[model samples]
Target: MVEIISIYNYVMRRILLIQGLIGLSLYDEIGQGYLNEIDLECYITDIIPTLAQVSNHLHPSFERFYVCTVVKKVFFFLDHLHTRRIRIKDIVSSGLLSQLLELRDSAKSRDLVVNETGNWFSMPAVLEVYENYLDLDRDHDGMLSKKELSQYGSGSLSPIFLDRAFEVCRTYNGEMDYKTFLDFYFAMEYRKTLSAMHYIFRILDINQQGYLTAQTLRYFFDGIEEGIKAVKTVK
Candidate 1:
């Protein structure tokens, strides 16, 4: 009976690991080729955890090994996308995101958060986005003041990008609130027009608050998105 149980556990773990690799491959293909600027972030934050959990459960020895693997792949895919300047929509239409999400429930038994760091290593891209936004809000107020926005890199942003971002923010009917600023910032960074801006706003506006204060934004963004985003941004 004991021998049988050990074999069963080993086989199950192996199966889970295989499933995770398959899922990661699918995500890489889609993320590298299809996802939109906004959807890319969503996919990273939401779907990657599901994959990591599956992998970890199957391969328990590595201590979040599955998550670490997924994160590395995600970062590579994003780097390739950026290098090629690929359009995110093209990737989505290819049907990869939906396929990846389909595996989420299968891996529900495993905890995506690793005990070592108490962090989700599977979704580094999400982390990067959260960190970038949080870094902008130095004062840590719920809202981002104009002073905070202005201090983003001393001339690191090109004149064209800065002017364009500023112009977009100005059109928000006032001094560009946090939501408006994030929308513009993402649009510029992702090289998407304003159409993608709406998605960015929706993702950041967790808690259905209709407005994203730094606090609420960080909670959801850092909790989920940060891990995913971290994958892409880390050097």
Candidate 2:
């Protein structure tokens, strides 16, 4: 049963990939028409440089192109999800969503160089993120040890969702090992956290000071608070 579900997921992912490629190819043409009304310059040269920079940042190996291809595939999947208005939170449980978002926020904080006192995070902080995620597994299965939990539903998720996850987990042909399960869980969670961290680091270099300090930290925290409050007010 688990094998069947895994196969199903694999197939769905492929379909999403194909659809994403189609969308990406159309993006430039569609974007141009949309941007035409605006005063912004639509020069391909200007756009290419930005793309080159981003591509370089994402991949240092231009000659060994498979890395770029894989990255594009992943990007396509994410773009499709966004275009479809499918929240990552909806695909995974709220607990997991919160964890991902928290990691993203922490990454942002780190990037913004918030808490310039060098108290942003350390080894212990990193472990805390892992521990918090494990605690959400609920079944004490040593890992998230479930597929549905990693795949579908939201909020606390229903017992039905958990059951599905467990069922999917059990479908493996061989007895699953702990390390393998942990690898799967951590890989997905860590990717989200790392992506968030990268962006956070980019925006918070206020003083060009190699490290953040107390004042910078306070300013960053206050800004986050204001943003959150504004979001809440609008909602």
Candidate 3:
């Protein structure tokens, strides 16, 4: 039964890819067969109104923010290397475009759509992520300083972890852009993915080496211990 289910899902995914390609073909119309950031932004903006019809969770006032957040997510995942553009093939293969298209179906309940926390294109999920970013940007600077980001998620992440994130991940001066923050968020939230693991490993590999050594592990472990002690002291 498991094998059958796997095969069925494979077929359905292929069909979804084909459907996504047909729907998105016009966006890559110059025969470039890809979408640069501006092209993708326009495409997503055009579809937002249709998506809004079924997205009772999204507010009219927040549609612009929602669109910007979703576009950033697509680039973060599908472009993977921050390339500023993506091939339609990659978009279709990632199934994100298909997932966005699926939201157009009025048949899907608002509860079901909003609860798909793992789906990047989910309206409620994107809004939640955007809100979190806004809350963290206390300075209204549109970017997160180390002090601002340290307050993320109960403030429990080790100082060393954040230090390495700023060191290894792309940042503007000493602050992290929303896109880079999304990368950090994804690494922490979906640690099982290869990309996420690689990101985490990069931060942990303090010497810029390709692999983690026992010394590296010990260094972070010590940082974690100190963080725990500090948290306990506060209580």
Candidate 4:
């Protein structure tokens, strides 16, 4: 027997979700029916005590890192304008807030608690990303230089590719900050997704003329060619 849910039920469920999120927005303080970074951070922090029930491995000191990472991820996907605030409508439509709230009673399974289908609120996922950044940072600095990032993903990425990344990505003193690194990490990890593909496309479209040219392809490919020669020499 198929348990079919009617359209009316689906609409009612959506309405309830929006209502709940609007109530959560009371934390906005400015009367803006949106959650700013601080608001989101505070909300997540409040839930951490309950979330700990399912996340036994979470250390006390890691709370700050967890909150910051989750908030950044939410905004990265939902804050389309990079405004640092997510409107209730956007939050409801994305269903991200509901997924986040579910952490309060999520199952205790390691795999479920960790990745949870790439959930932003997953403790293990956030920790893994932070740990990866720490490993690559090498200097103990809170930023990654092009040389450090070169050590990423088999360490075979081309110099011209790195140049284009640095040219396009947000950096300070020629280094990538954690927030910026998150963007780079996702673009690489989910390269097949439209958003990630668009990001990579921007990097490839070096001229920023809104399109990719064969000359640009050759320019980056030259670096890959050189890399192959170097590997052959090593062998």
Instruction: State which candidate has the highest TM-score.
Output: 4
Q: Each model's TM-score?
A: 0.33, 0.21, 0.77, 0.78
lDDT at 110 for candidate 1? 48
Please tell me which predicted candidate would have the highest lDDT against the true structure. 3
Question: Total clashing residue pairs per candidate?
Answer: 28, 8, 0, 0
lDDT of 3 by residue, 66-106 (tens): 67777776776676555678888888777688778777756
Question: Model 3 segments beyond 4 Å from truth?
Answer: 1-19, 29-32, 52-61, 81-85, 107-119
Score candidate 2 by lDDT: 0.36
Q: What's the lDDT for candidate 1?
A: 0.45
Better of 1 and 4 by lDDT: 4
Candidate 1, residues 152-205, lDDT tens digits: the string is 654244333343344434334324444455444545465453445454454455
Residue 64, model 2: lDDT of 23
| Candidate 3 residue pairs in backbone clash | none
Candidate 2 lDDT tens digits, 132-180: 5455566666445344243322333333323333443333443233333
Predicted candidate 4 versus true structure: per-residue lDDT over 1-235, tens digit per residue: 2335577767767776775576567678987688898888887777676664334667878778777787777776776445668886777678777666555554544446444446566666787888889999999888999999999887889988998899988999999998788878877876776657777888899878988788988888898999889889999
Candidate 2, residue 56: CA error in Å? 28
